[model samples]
Every structure is written in C-alpha cells, then in structure tokens.
Target: MIQNKGEMTVEEVRLNEGHAFLKGKLQADLLYVGEEDGRIYSLSANLPMEETLNLDGIVNGDKMCLKWEIEDLSIHIIHSRKMNIKAVVTFFASVDELTGVRLPVSLDDETVSVQKKTMRVLSLVIHKKDTMRLKEEITLVSNKPNIAELLWYTTEVRGLDLRPEENSVKAKGELFIFALYTGDDESGTLQWIEHSIPFNGEVECSGCISEMIPNLEAAVINQTLEVKPDADGEERKLQADVVLELDMKLYQEEDHEVIMDVYTPFRQCMPKGRKEILESLLVRNFSRCRIADRIEVKETQGKILQICHSQGKIKIDKIQIVKDGILAEGIVRLKVLYIVENDEMPFYSMEAMLPFSHVVEAKGITENSVYYLHTELEQLSTTMVDSNDIEIRATIGLNVLVIQCSEEMILEKIEEIPLDQEKIRNMPGITVYIMKPGDTLWNIAKKFYTTVDEIIQMNNLDGDEVSSGTPLLLVKKVEE
Candidate 1:
C-alpha cells in the first residue's frame, strides 16, 4: 500500500461571509493545498515542519476543539511564508498525531459519519539511524481534528456564579448546570438529634442498649435476671421531661432538563443572549464541545436565577450572631442566641414553631443597615413543686443553659442531671402532710394552700373517698 504525505493548498478555506463569528482569528482549509507526492500521503497542516506541533495524545477519530493558543504560532514562524485558515470546523477519519493533520477520506459526503478504524506505524529521524534500521513510534489517532466533527452525548455548563445579595462582596455563587439523567426517584434522607431527660434524686435508668432486640427470652428465669440485679442506680432522673431540639431543612430537586427552541428567553426576558445561539446547534454536532454558542460568550448561562432557597433566619430577643462560612449562594449561615430574662425564664419552657431562615434579595441596604429583625424567642417553662422549690426547664426546640438564674442571659438545654437529695425532698410533693378533721381532699387542699389532686397524689388516692377522721397526705396546690 502506498502511504500519502497529507498536504493541500490553502485555497479550500470556506468563508461564511457575514458570519458574526468571523470577527476573530480564523483557521480554515484555505491553507490545505491538494498537494501530493507520487505516492499517497497521510495528512499535513498549514504549519511549517519546524513548528513541531504538539497533539495532546489525540487518537484517530477522537474529537478535537479550538482553544486560544497561549502564544502566537504565526509570530514564532516569522520568516516562513505565513498561511491562515478561516478557522472553519472539519471532520477527520484518519489522523497523524505527530504531524497534527487529517487524512483524506475515501468516501464522498459533505457530512460523514465514520464507520471503521485503522492504525499505522511511522518513524521520524531524531538525529541518526544505524544499519538502515528506523525506530518507529506507533500511535493510533483520530482523523477528526475539530470538536464540532465528533459525536458527543454529554453537555456541561460551568462557571455560573450566583450572587443573591450584592457585588464586590464575598457573595454566594453556584453553577446551575443542566443534565438529562436516565432515571428518577433518586432520593436520600438525613437526620440528627440531641436528647435529654430531667433528673431528680435516686431514679432508675436502663443503660444504653447495645443492640435492638426483637423479643426477649420468654422464660420466668430470664425475666428475673433481666431485672438487672444490683443494678443499683444512683438516683438519676426518675421524674423528668424528655426534650428534643430539632432543626428542619429543605432542598430543591436537582437534575432536570427542559426542552425549548434555542432562542427561548432564559430567566424571563433575560436574553437567551443574542438569539444567534440557535445557529450553534449546527456546531453541537458533537456534545463535549465546550464552545459557548457564539452568542452567550460566557461558558454557561449567566443570569438572575430564581432560587426559592427557603432557609430563613430566626427572630429572637437578644441575639449573639456566630458566623462560620458562606452558603452555596454566598450568603452567611448565622448562629444566633436568644436572650431570656429571669422574669421570662418560665416562658422558655414552652416550645414554639421555629422560624424559617433563608436568603433574600436585599435592596438599598447599606453596610450600616440592619439586615433583618429576629423574632425567635428563647422558650422556657417552670412549675412550683409541692414544697415550693421551683424546677425550671427548656421546652422542646429550646436549649437550657442553666437551672436557676436571678438575671437574664442566653441559655442552652442540657440533660437535667438528678438534683441533690435535699433539693428533691424540698420540692412540693416530695413529702406528705397528714389530714385533719373537716379536711376533705379539696377542703384540706384549700386550707393548706395545696391542690385537691395534690392531696390525692400524696395519699395515692384513686377516688374522692375521704372520712372525717381519716388521715391523708398533702400533695400540691389546686389553685383558684
């Protein structure tokens, strides 16, 4: 087989006159002279041999695209006859990676789809060869040298920076890329919790379970052993309230693709940019082409995105803001503390629906402007025990910073460890008072400033059965 050295005159370069893209430097077929030796040549480019063109491991049939040359190749070849191409796209089937050229195709078609593949072994003289033997480098490369010539299925949009609030600041930005996935119902769930229980003197508690058991051994002997003999708990929280502080989160769905005419407006009236991008669909001949449709000069769509990102800020009394870092959109996710006064300490115990914190577009707000007003409150609750000692606690969704406070401050919720025996004994119903004549549970409750229910609870009474001479224990107050 006769091998051809690829070469052609520069006359074939096609010029799309009036093309908006023609404004820049061009590399078209104008330089490929249909020159040929007595034998068939592989391929050649407009570049001189001394130029030493570097092919990025391009294999035959591999898709190639245009990128700005870091240095001017024409300047480097100063003295040589300068050749320029219109920078028109080309398709190749056979390639010479070493020479950076595409071989002629046997078939005839203005637009061709490659069918078969072939490779070759060629040699270049570095300096010398001994005994008529040549050292050859065998590399397989693609004939197609233009990205617009190959078949690509995947498309990417990148470098989309999103600034919800302002510019010149370290605002949040994200690349909302498009995707055409093969399936749906792809989802995941995330969760976390900090649990606590209130405590008072010697209470029983089971150790943390190592594993979940479905059924315990159904035997009397096992039941006794499971009782945990000598488990002797050192009075933990026997009487307590369980609280869980939860943070709810929400995220929008990703991986969706919409189809519309390439000329359709994106982000509403915000320019699908020049409407000329519709022409590039012709160049999309291949997918991986990073070429921005000649119209949207940006690598990807850059516009005002509609983000219903609903992570809202909480409105609280006195707030201490602790910031960590910027969110995906460049907004600051803040940590705020709500201050509670001793007079309002009891209010902290009742949990209210937490706030919805999110990013919002700020208008006319300056560096000195107050961004938002926090309305979240530090929740709390308290009850006077039978003995008049107060037990203050943080209700659900709130944290307890401390047990007793004479002044106002920020507080967090912690497990109420068991109180001292003295404190427990001092609580309202810890001790019982004996009943006297004319003291019905309700009557005695009123006289002693206690509750009828407290009296029944004190004596473990199931009903209103109270004999005049009967003795009963006093529990707590039944207020008017």
Candidate 2:
C-alpha cells in the first residue's frame, strides 16, 4: 500500500441515567499499486462502531459534549487483495451544569446590616452541534489534461470564518482539493490537478444573535469528488460534495451584586458556603508554524526520478503552558509518491514521521487556564535534494481557544437565629479595644453586633479604613 487516511464520525449520541451511548463509523481510503497491471489503484472501507460509556452524575436533561481522536492505526496485509485494518479511537465526554448561588441581599430586621459585593461572571447562552453541506461543480482549464481514471484524492478545509446572525451562523472557507489520475492521452502518463475552491453556507442555530461571543469548531467529516461529462460530452467537469461538522458554544457576560459575607447584628447569622468554578473566554488565536527537514533514503528502497504527490497529517502529542505561551509538541505523518528509475516498477512511495515543537503566544495564560487546540497541515511539498535524500517543507496551522478558570466560595444558604440574650446583657457598656493585624471595621462591628458607622463615630475616626495596633474606644449598644 502506498498511503492511507482515516477519519471518525459520530452519528448518534444518547444520554440516559448515568450513562451515554455513542454510535459512530470509521472511514478510510487507501492507495496501492496494482500487482497484475503495475498501475495505481484505490480502495475504500468503512467500519461501524457502537460503545456505551458510564458517566457519573449524568441525567437525561443535562448538556453533554463529546470529542474523539484517532489515537493509532495499523494496517496488515494478509493476501494480495485483503488486509486487516486496526484502529484505536479515543472519545472524551463532558457534561456542563448550570449552578448558581443564592445570596441574601437584605434582612427583615431593621438593626441588621448586610455586606454585598459586585462580581462579574460568565453565563452560557447556547451549546449545540450542527452540520452543513456544500456542493460545487468545477471545470478544468483548457491547457490541463482531461481525466481518464482517478487513483487518489484529498480534501482539506481551511481559513474558516464564522459570523453570528439572528437565528443562524454564516460560515465561509476554502477547500484545498488535489487529485492524481492518468490523462486521456496515448502516453498514459500520470497527471494531477490542484485547486482552491471557496464555499459559504449558513447553519441554523437557535438563540444565536449578533455581538455574542462564539467558540466555534469545524471539520470536514465527509467529502466526495467524481468526474462527470460536460455539456459537449467530454469528461472535463468534476462534482464535489462536502459535509462539515460544527461544534458551537456561545457565552454572555453578566454582572451581579453577590453577598460574599453576611452577618445580622440584631441576631446570629451564618453563611453556608460551597466552592464553584467560573470560566471566561480569554482569546481565540490562529497561528502558523513552519516545518523543514530532510529524509535520507537507503540504497535498498530505490533511486528517485521525479516527484508526483505529497500528503500529510498533524498529530499533537502533548501541550504545556510555559512562560511565554503554550508549547505544543507533536509529529507530522507525511507520505510521498514519486517516479523511480526502473522499468518494472515505475512508481514508488514512502512515509516519514517528522517531529516538531512550537510555542504559541498567549500573554496571560496560567496553569489554571483551559485550552482547545486543533492542528492542520496547510501546505506541504517534497523535493529531491540528491539521489539519496528528499527535502520536505511544510506549513502547519494552529487554531487555539483559551479560557480562564477560577474558583470562588459561593453562599448557597444562610441560617439566622435569635442572638443569645445572656451574652449581650453581660457585655460591658463601655470598653477600650486595641486593633491588631488584618483588622477591619466590618469585622469588629459584626463581632459586637454593631455597625461600621457607629464604630467610626465612637472612635472619632476619619473613615472605615484604620491602621493596625491603633487604640480605640468601643461602646456597646443599649436597648432603647
């Protein structure tokens, strides 16, 4: 086999009590040289998959998100026309629940005082998954050769631009299409065509509006290219159909006056607290990194003559948050087909794994930050350096979206009861108090069941701000 490419698709996702059911399929395209005729040929295969996953604290009505990757693929040849393909797929699932804290803003008793704070938080507006279909008919130029038989092809979706609308999203991108075939000439030589086709489509997304923050992801899940006859009855036109999968998440910014601490001076009150995490969108960046290397060919393989076609895929192994930005380490799997200096076998192919490390600039990224990164091969080319080495130059595109996560103690509930009368009555009417480190006027007032204004008035202070180790007089309030 010369080369193979595979992709995964999720057909259905069902959520039940503490469990999730997934239905998907793996599609692969393979290219190989024909043993009988010594010509290039192609084969396609599909493998259906069904899996049940156990999820803790998951229900039917909760929102669940899922993602998958092709961890590994191995192809074994058993006979001349049969092979065993093994694929290891990994799926990640998550559920997002909307949790809130209820804070007491006011007390019924007139003598009680409440402390409030204003906080900015992120609120999720919508989370959904959608799909879009694009179709186009491309005609070859006059100088290019007509297609006789197509052996291999590849499609890449890049430069995606999305805009929010009232009830949908406008998406636009370019498809890089490449195909290798034998021309309709007597020579029967290999000919290839490459083109960049621009396409735009609209996705129906409920509750989507303009000026909303959107974290969107798109992928070319399925595509097809076929040769067709033109109006003059010549095989000069090609029909292209593509399907794109969209993962959309939108958020809105809101401000609320939350009660950080609550205490009632007229009675005893305590706040029941719980830890909650809040996440906000930091930045969305699309960056590019270049890769260049040389592959040395051994004498046993063959001698190169001319380059034909090259294809590649990027696989990210690890990502880390560093001082300057996010560091991504990964490998690029590249396959090249070329003409060899031989009569029996005129074509040869080779595969190489090139390692790379790149740093994406993110100014304020920390350890607590979360990121979603996707890598793609924007451009790749192979050139013959000498008889035994090939030079490879490629451009890798990086799309990253980062969010900041922070934890806060939220007041879930507040319990209030009557104060102890004996303790209040035994307290002295007048006394001298000395301030210590980390002392605040509000803390002292809450301890004595008084107000900050009364403390400042009794101490003859300028304001609530007071230094440590300062001596002041305290007066207990008496029932009128």
Candidate 3:
C-alpha cells in the first residue's frame, strides 16, 4: 500500500480479479549401494474457513462497498508409507571397473507462497498418474469470508541395474508415492508413502557405456538436489555440482555410483477469514485432465510444480523418485509471477516438503508420465545396517493479501496523443464562428470548444447534422 505516484489523490482504482535419498554399497563388493531416507505423500494445499474478512463492526471513513460468503469449505492432503526397501547408506551408487557401481537416487519437492493485505488466489493444481497415484485441486473467489492455502512438492528416482556384471552383483532400488489433495470436506482421499533403499556404488573403470547399445548399452545413474527453507534447523547444504545420469545399451566402460534418499518438506503459514466462491473437497473427473501451464500465484509451492505436472523427466540428478504407480499421467507447467492487489493481513499460509519415488511395474500412457532405473544385493557388506527407517515430511500453506493496483499515466503537462494548440485558447469555448447557411448541432455548438451535448458526442452526429457547411471536429474529452 505504498505506491506514491505523485498523488493529487482521487483514486478509486476499480477492479479486481486475481488468483528423497539413497546410499549404500559394497566396499566388500567394492561398495554395492546404500544410504537413503524417505517422505512424500503430496497434494494437500490446505483448506478450512469462516472468519469473513474483518468486520468486528466499523462505522465510519468511506465503506463504499465490499461483500463475501462461504460455508462448509474443505481441502487438504499429506501422506506416505514405504518404510525402507533396503539401504545402509547405499541406495544410490556408481563404482564399476572390476565390475559394479550404478546406483544414486533421491528427489524432494518445493514451491511456496504467503501474503496478507489483499488476496484473491483462485487456483492451484498438481495431478499425476504415477508414484502410486495422485490428485490436488484448489479454487477461490472472495470479498469477505476467507481462509486460503496451497503448497506442493515432488521428488523421485527409479531402478538402477546397469546390466553386465559377474564378481559382484548388488544393485537394488525401491521408491513409491501416492496422493489426492482436494478436500473441502473429505472426498478425494488417498495419501500413501513408501521407501526402500539399496544401491551399492561401484564402477572402477572400463570404457563404453554410451555406444548405441540396446543390444545392451544403458547406465545413467545421476542424483543431485538442493532445496532451502529452514526456519530453525539450519537448512541449505548441498554443493559441488549436481549430477545423476544413467543411460546404457552395452559398454565395457565403467565409472558408475548411485545412492539416493533426500526427501525434505516443512512448509507452514496459516491465517484465514474471507470467501465468495471457494472449492476443493475432491471430486475429480477432469474429463481425463489436460491443460497444465498457468502456475504462478507465486510459484504455487513447488518442485517446479512437480516438473509442471509430469513427463519423461531428465535432469542434473535430484534425489529419490520413481513413479510408475502412485497415480498416472504427467506434465504440469505454468508461469505468472505476481499480481498482488494491496497487502497486509488479508490472508497468508505457507508450507512445503515432499520426497518422492515410484515404480511397481506401471508403465507409460495410462495417460502419460513414464521415466526411468535399479540397484540390489542383500548380503549386508558395507557394514550391515538396516531397520526400516524411511522418513521425509511436508506441511505447506501460505496466504498473504493486500492488493489494488492500476497504472496508466501520461498527463505530464497534459495531452500528448496530439492536441495542445495553445490549450485551445485557454479552452472553454474557443471563439471565431462564421459559417451559417444552416449550421447544425444547435448552430455549431454555439460556435466553439464544447457543449451541444458535446457536439453530438464529438461529431458522431445523427441528431445534429448541419448541412450546407461542414467543418466539425472538436475535442476536449467527449465520450458518453
């Protein structure tokens, strides 16, 4: 509310419309693959209302007009269940020359927002057909009666086998996901989580892992991630260039290492009271769903909105994610940065953290989303350490409002789209009139710069046509 554009002040700006990890392996098998933790059960942007945009009762200083209404509204999601497939600090690896090393996986989610002083965010969506399952929907319309919240996350990885091994065979990988966040009163419910880590690192040095060999030439194991937002736990620790690539067809070359399990989520911000048209209680039939590409109410809480919904997904390597089942269909992308109306205690909520991984034999086009990997060998050699410990959490909700913005200035000294002929001789009816012969518009608007119903709406004459002498084209602001 601090936009002092040289105020002569007379403003009434009419307007309104707005909206994983893994590690482990055989120092024994030369490092097999181990080390990972988990947490990801997404699609719960927050929902709960009933306060009605401030009205303890004020009786003064221009109330003009403002209104709102909403009852029994709900929407919320946050769930997971995949204890620990198998990992003792070796779920992602890369170490094979003697023969072994191609494991590294771990992916987590991020995207957040919160404002207060004005708010009218009416949308936030992330639906998937992988991980285990998925769904999340949010919509709003308010003037009064408020409570807003939306926060999302994404992280993933897959089986990393790399093929062709003998003296050491230990490449085991596992990750899963499931979500359904669309609740205005419980309807779309399903949030499950699971994480199993086992990817021992090895790939001493051979040469030939990228030669067009599907005859068997594939091994791309990459895992790189860095997300920050730590209120008290000192967040931000992941440096030295992120890299996770696994593509093979048949090669004697070897230098592979994979280990993943770094799912982090902790988004929080809550405040509510205003409504007019709110929805999200889960009842999705999106006719199959397809329109993604509009996310930006301030990043809408993200992992790039889970890679804009979902697709093939190739990267510099983030951690823990494998979606073949959890839900299906992927590809969600959007961008609209900001449009705040005012600002200061109108609505704000923020929370984020979702670790992901999926794969249970559920491939391509059930609608869409199909990405790739695997590691496994349980002889407990890197030092035998495991006991079902999969943990990664999230809680994202942010609402902040204070909006009323409109700018269209060009008055400096006045009139510049052509027109200043000496201010029309100080305006207010310019003199010089002599063209009788049946003049019109009531005799040329009495001869000069204005009136006569503004010269019949500035010469669009129909009831002011003066025949015999035509010379009319006056201007000084005339538009009904």
C-alpha TM-scores of all predictions: 0.12, 0.83, 0.16
Regions of model 3 farther than 4 Å from truth: 1-205, 209-211, 214-240, 245-328, 331-339, 345-480
Cα RMSD to native, each candidate?
41.4, 3.8, 33.2
| CA lDDT of every candidate | 0.22, 0.81, 0.24
Candidate 2 structure, TM-score to reference: 0.83
Best by TM-score: 2
**lDDT minimum window of 10 residues, candidate 3:** 1-10
| lDDT at position 309, candidate 2 | 73
**Candidate 3 structure quality by residue, lDDT tens digits, 1-480:** 100001011112222121011112211101011123211122211112212122233323322222111111222112232121211221121212121212222212222111112222222121111111112121222221111111222223344433334322223343222111222333322121222333444332233223311221122222222323233433222111212222222312222221211111121212222222321111111112122111122333221211112211221123222332323222211111111222221111221212222223432213222122222111110110121111111111111111112221111111114333564556553233434675655435433434556566666767655666565665443111
Query: In model 2, what is the error at residue 429, expressed in angstroms?
Result: 3.9
Q: Give the C-alpha lDDT of model 2.
A: 0.81
Tens digits of lDDT, candidate 2, 199-252: 889999888998777778777777989999999888888888899888888877
Q: Write the per-residue lDDT of candidate 1 for residues 1-480, one digit (tens) a residue.
A: 111112212222222222112122222111111223221112224432111123444443442322121111221222334433222222222222233222222334322211222322122212111111111111111221111111101111112121111111111111111111111123211111112222121111122121211111000000000111122442111111111111111111122122111111011111121111110000000011011111111212222122111111222223332232111111111211111222212011111233232222232323322221211222322333322122333211121111111111111111223324453345565344555665555445443445555566667778767765666665433222
Error of 1 at 362 (Å): 4.7
Candidate 3 RMSD to the correct structure: 33.2
Best by lDDT: 2
